[model samples]
Target: MTKALTPGSIAPPFARYSHAVEIPAGHRLVVCSGQLGIDSQGDVPPDVEGQTRLCFANIAAILAEAGMDLSDIVRINAFVTGREHLPGYMKTRDEFTGSPPPASTLMIVSGFARPEFVVEIEVIASAP
Candidate 1:
């Protein structure tokens, strides 16, 4: 299992994520590549909410292949095209991560490999 960490020496997390995570010994890690909003049909959603959901859906598919789920995620790196997508991102993330979410980093980038893509998410997961 993965444990969320919040050291008293440091300020608490500002949002839904922990400051760090501790994965138990003897566990292996599954690091996922950045997941884009593109669906199986090779179509990118127009809205941030749909794209955000698709990103997680792609991530979930990858995790499932590894015999794990979102609950095993320890860290997440999100790259968004604009800051306006924060609220939608947070809500969608909460839908998947539940309580004690993974350590998270949000980056506002100018663009992505494809102009139609609005968001990309990458995760690091623990596996026993």
Candidate 2:
């Protein structure tokens, strides 16, 4: 079983994640492919908020396929078109990762292949 990060004002709700993950030996890790904001219909959602939400949903589905959840995530990476919607991005992230939240890296890029597309996400999870 995996343990949530210990709580504290200064601590990241959990003790370890990504570069911060501190698991012992004898455990398995599951790394997920980068998830996009596209729907199962293969349609990329418009708007950063919508795309970000869809990306997390896609990530969740992948985690379930591997018998894991967002809490088991050690590291997360998010790429966006620009910084205009960053605060909103954080809000979208808060919905999936609450309390201490996860170790995340957010980047702003010039654009994506699909012009309508606004975001892409990736995650790494491990267990004992």
Best by TM-score: 1
Worst 10-residue lDDT window for candidate 1 reads 92-101
RMSD of each: 1.0, 4.0
| Candidate 1 lDDT over residue span 1-128, tens digit each | 67888899998888889999898999988999999989999988898889989989998899999898888889999999898988888888888894578999999999998898888999999979
What local lDDT does model 1 show for residue 74? 92
* TM-score of model number 1: 0.95
Candidate 2 structure quality by residue, lDDT tens digits, 6-125? 435564432223224455578677888777788989887567788889988888888888888777777788888888868777778878874345567888988777788777788877
- Residue 124 lDDT in candidate 1: 95
**lDDT of all predictions:** 0.89, 0.72
